[model samples]
Target: MEFRCKKAGDECYGVKELTLLSEISQRLIQTKELKNDLSVILELLVRHLDAERSFLTIFNRQNSKIYIEAAYGYSSAQQARGKYDLGEGIIGRVIELARPIVVDKISESNLFLNRTQQELKSKDGKDLTFVCVPIIEESQVTGALGLLRLYNPYITKDENLYLLSVIGSLISRVVSSKQEQMEELEALRQKNQELQSKLDDGQRPVNIVGNSGKMRDVYSLVNMVAETNSTVLIRGESGIGKELIADAIHYSSKRARNNFVKVNCSALPDSLIESELFGHEKGAFTGADSRRKGRFELADGGTIFLDEIGDIPLSTQVKILRILQQREFERLGGTETIKVDVRIVAATNRNLEEAIEKGEFREDLFYRINVFPLYIPSLRERRDDIPLLVDHFIEKFNKRNGTSVKRITTSALNMLMIYSWPGNIRELENCIERACILTTDDVIHSYNLPPSLQTADSSNTQARGGLMYTVEQVEKQLIREALTSTKGNIAKAAELLSVTERMLGTRVKKYEIEAWRFKV
Candidate 1:
């Protein structure tokens, strides 16, 4: 850490500082990835400044809040805690004033908020110095960059302020470029949604049954991209109807008349996947007996859905990327390249971005298939749609099972509503089907549902009382149903409920039932 004295007129860096600036500029130019590169830049700043910590904060105008975008030497928890509103703290004040602030010693300054709860002292007995400068872009304050270092009597605060201000200018360019890119993408998405809204005019997907806000958004995205040949990536948890989304897109598209092929990547072994997707020449492998066309070839001029795409092997990902890019791939063990026009619709429950970071998934393939991404909301997220989904599944199951079960009772519906559908719509359908089979009468009851839905966390019925109380409530409900079916005839109602008239009379008196109201 050596430097020449400040020039008499101009604020210029010394040789070492100039070299550091050059290195930072080269690194920023080398990578257009804002988040990843900003982190590298921050590390360089902390190391060059010999500082304890450094942070790059961004002010989101939409929310009117400032948060740390990147940090050096700070835990993720600490970074999350480092948030401020306008005029709230040092970082906020720097952006608010659009000027740099240099505190000689953090321990002596009342303005230092210490929001991240970091120690304000060096390993030695010295207090820490703090410097923050606003990052201005296009004559507007966008964010601030801050640095913390051990205080030294020999170094002047003005020098620290100047260094940070220079670094902030470099950062301003990167953040501004990133913000512009995001704004462009958001604008395009908004335009597509508007067009979709006008075209659909509140029309739901013909096969899908949901009118919730989140599902409507999904519908809009589906309608927006369905007519195009763009590759679609559907993301959601397992059984969240990702495949249904794929179906809506493919069936609504211009290629609806063509073959729609589906490949479940997770279901096939790694060795068989290549052959399954790209086909194989005769005798290509130990099991290859004859020439077979692959899903891509079979789906020529149509859409091919690759479900659980995150499980695809890395070796096969390259061929998938090539197909997405050039619409061509050679069959396994064959040199001749085959060309096919196939639109891809990939679905994955796994976090593909996390997989890329862990070196398990290919980033190139991700970007290729992410042209039109659609995120299906989880069942718990759209609980308002549960009843409609329930009715749909009930009608479906009733038709399949040849039962005349009508509707679910209010108690049963309440249990379904309160329980979190962890397995999402698929789990809900399974539950409804089982209940329909067990239901003796036309109406489904709470007791007809599975035992899992009866837990305290799911339905909160235990809050009223324990197991005995729950049983008593169900007993009362059954007795009331029997009385209603008998049209208030106590003897017949007692017989229907399989209880003695004396016992049934005592229970009716205990529950205070108005049996005359049900008389025909």
Candidate 2:
């Protein structure tokens, strides 16, 4: 009899195994749509196992919540979402032990073992055999599968315990396959992220963000420059994240572990700019009391960032030209020529070529740093990234402030997409951070946006006076109202309007509105 019972268990497990395999094949063929299919699968499992009622109770580890995703032989109105302590009910016991439970009779078993009289109270006229099974996947008991028969016995006429375990094993495979698919999809997602990371591996931090065509070119250029010690010049508007791109390049390359030194040529005093970059000996000048290494010396065998390079005075430009050309420099009050090996990455918001033409910047110096040039399109160019960037920022600021800002209302998002972003990502980041700090609800609605963005409706009403305008008129008025509401700053406008700068820029271009040309 024991041998027959063991064989019966194997047969049941075998049938369940086949069912689960079929489910997996079906699931794999359908791609990422997994939830709906789960319900149908569980319902059939209950019927095949000859149980009167069944529940697929999944434990949400993230929230410590239990959700019944699927049920069989039960009405939807019955409230299948029965709460269970992590170790409370019979179902909880299966989960607590990470194993399955088979009870010949529930009235006599010690298994309905929750602390509550709520669970101890049996449903009226619902005496039945019970089977509680924990669904284990990747060594974690994610949920439990259980069944109760109201008027009859759970064991088939075959009296097969093997059949019961077989069905349990089948359900286990289904759960395992679903998790495996999710993991596989995640692996693919991470691989794509690595590919995206291949960009930003060089000189002056790139000024561009997003994976649009133009931005991808910028990333590729950064990678190519990072592989060798080259003079890279970055051209972009103010607040375009130029420093970020520069950091990406230096940190992603072969010299990633080395130092990355940065200096703002325009931020330093004109008198001290040259010495700050090339270093000065003790007693070289008034404050030269101790020997100090310049940016180049600190960046030796690595990369140095020169920001706002266009602002360097002609006197300092000559010294910079010497460093680029000679790869050697002499500190103030010193006769020794110090040789240095450093990759230079420079950024500017000015037209260096025009500067050279005007004889303000040396022609040779312009060409020297221009060996690998990466020009980032302004906020107006890749407006498509506005929405994506908005979501990115929301996720970012939510963590920063430790709040769960789950969503932004569609109207609010639409507003942001219509406005131009002149200040680019910096402005957008500030807007989101502010919203995070101030929003009182889980979702940020349109009314929650800043006052600048709120003025668009009023401006639109004032301009159109409730007229049904043409598409062109509506588009123009909308963009105009958004910009006027947010002022001329594109990133601000984009945020106020809840649109991407790229989208807003497209409208500006489509309508040929000439006031918002992007300038670095």
Candidate 3:
């Protein structure tokens, strides 16, 4: 280490402390015990630089506490405790603002709490300067370091601040790794909580099913978008599973525990859509007997799925745009602007661009939500998924109808494959529900096909011949093809199939396929 003195007024380098501080940094990587590692590093940096006192605080978000995990040079009484609140003093301010701050004059900085000023004075009144540095994790401020000093002629606050930043980086990696591990454990805990809840409820009410290329695209998009705050637009014809995709998006997000609200934009009358979306004060108008929170207000810190948005009235489009743009909105007949952190996931079968051109939709609103567009292909487009979807709907309806139907007849599945699903997945659902209601046997046979789906014998033969198998048979064939295409690589097969890895695994088990033999 070299030698020099820092001027009292200088806001810059303490040249004398540079070499020793650099050396302190080099030793940080070799230390293993996190607490000891940080303590040793900060202790060396402060001591070698002749600082009077130093401390490190680790943010505890769960309890809103910041424990003083490390400290040196303070009196035995002052350094005994290892904790403080988030904004209790200048130290907390560093974490709050995520910036470095220096208080050359104690009374002037205004960062001092009564206790903090008293504690600093106890350490040494000779040095009037102090510096605090923020520690960050995942681009977020997590904790801070506070350095105090006596009237040391050898060191300065600016040098200490720089050292703190460099040291904070090393400590942050350790803290962040611990934080991430804790988060993963917390996630597993939460997932277990949800599972326990699902178990308590008997069975989950919602389940997704599909194994097709189009569906695989939807699955891939869902996983990719789940990690972001992107606004998704799901476009598909009516009867398609737009709501299903919307649910998948929410359940896979960081805000999974929060509410996932769905609004049918078209189902509401232009007369009441405003009140329904943004809520209203008591007596906003007729039937507004009591004040209510709107969907946007209710879905704060969560996700809101707007369905059939293409059908919302033009006047209400303005309100939707404001909320999407500003992330804030006021209820009907209310003056207070309520801000919400809502992840907007909108779905509509109508062509929004065409609607915009016709003045039925707002161009700005469309662009705002079109950030991450997710257009769903119709059931007809993903016919390979028919059997999986059929199986899904069949199981659901069987439980609902209290029937024991376990299989879809091969010929019936083929018939389903050939029919152009004008109504999409929704139509298929209704068809399966009807089939379940009418079936007197274990198998959902071709004869159980609804009249809307049934056609003349020769055309039926041609249609069945067109697919060359029953709907059920085609479904099995598609599943087999998907598995083979991936060379029995179940995860890829699942992606090729459009179901979750779990769902694909289940099917693979049910079909007795040795999926493990395949290469990933």
Candidate 4:
């Protein structure tokens, strides 16, 4: 527990001591590589104090063990030998007691347990003086700093011990800071695993549609990550409903009651994107007449959906990256710092890795947002869910349009099933809505669908007889639509169809169509 230092009357000793302390403090503060910087600090200390060797030991409270973290003047084997339980050796005792320990001569002191098996004497054959000091933080010992030097008769026995204690205080700060970071990372890892396990016990997202194995996996991921504050990156092709997945995640989370703000990174012009995101004070820009809160601020205590995240400009990406890392930002024209407890749910259809290669995206930001990636499969990849989706959209549009369209005819449904939906679910929904409007009865027929859908390559029906029948069906449907659009005016209907009135009438008669029935 000794901590007293006798005043040295020699001016040279005082100057040397000040010089060592200044160098150690500067290096510890300036360098990001703390462990390597610490070794350098140890080397400085040993050279300044005229010591033979120096070492730092850290206590792992979880395991009740102490091991060397950094060292100077010790071989790899010697450093590897330095490990101890809480009260087993001198380093252990220094940490366990939260005190300094000094051995006048290693050979004569029974307490001097040389675990490293180094020679007891110096190169000059003088017994080495061993000194150990506890590295403490907030009144708790976390580690120890120790060094070996030949005994100096001119200096007091506890003189070097006091200097070691001061050095220990500096080491404690760096060691403790690193320990805190490690502890935080480990805690997050455990919490993530726990959340995954809880969701695996079978909670599904109620909002997202589809039961294909891929969609089910998406549902599981949404449920799993809903309870966590981790940032989520939803990757998929456009129209694959990434936004819907983002919606399910937000509404199912603890922040459901808070504002769930959404920002389309691609929709905003580059000139105004930063202002839209971080808000602006009045007079910040030419059009800024009043102060406005940004999407991040509005989503405080909730989640922000940054759709088309990859399309954000590189300049705005830096600010976004800062917000993701620090959860704080300053408004575009305001000096006041704003902090938000918002979870970010970013989505993009673009390949971010490719964007990174093209220098169009920030690599660090990519890693940050990609922590929990959820890839939504395209409609083609999960065609098994098409029937369910068709039914869902049918029921939805049915209620909206006050129509009793109960189902699609097999031929129409076959065409729908066969077409390559490059635009995914959104295209399917639009097709269903268009068909619902065209149908005059409960059943939607193939002729009522869009002409592009009836193409032989798309509908997979290319036989000569079948093609002729489909063409005729399409012609009849088109003439009926023209009549309806023209309100039974033959001339206007013919003009709309780009056909001569005589030919239109021939077709209408051939199909036995009642043109006047289309008049509302």
lDDT of 2 by residue, 248-314 (tens): 8788678778889999888899888878888889988997889877778888888899999999999
Supply the global lDDT for candidate 4: 0.82
Question: TM-score of the candidate numbered 3?
Answer: 0.50
lDDT of 1: 0.82
The lDDT, on a scale of 0 to 1, for candidate 3 is 0.72
- lDDT (Cα, tens digit) per residue for candidate 4, span 407-448: 877668666655667788998899889988998887789988
Please identify which of the two predictions, 2 or 3, would achieve the higher lDDT against the true structure: 3
Q: Write the per-residue lDDT of candidate 1 for residues 385-478, one digit (tens) a residue.
A: 7878988998998889998889998789777766667788998999999999999997889999998888746533343445665566557667
Q: What's the C-alpha lDDT at position 434 in model 3?
A: 83
Candidate lDDT scores, in order, read: 0.82, 0.66, 0.72, 0.82
Candidate 3 residue lDDT tens string, 27-53: 755666776666776777676655667
What's model 4's lDDT at 430? 92
Instruction: Show model 2 residue runs off by greater than 4 Å.
Output: 1-209, 454-520
Estimated TM-score for each candidate: 0.51, 0.50, 0.50, 0.50
Indicate the residue-level lDDT of 480 in model 2: 58
Q: Which 10 consecutive positions of candidate 4 have the poorest summed lDDT? A: 2-11
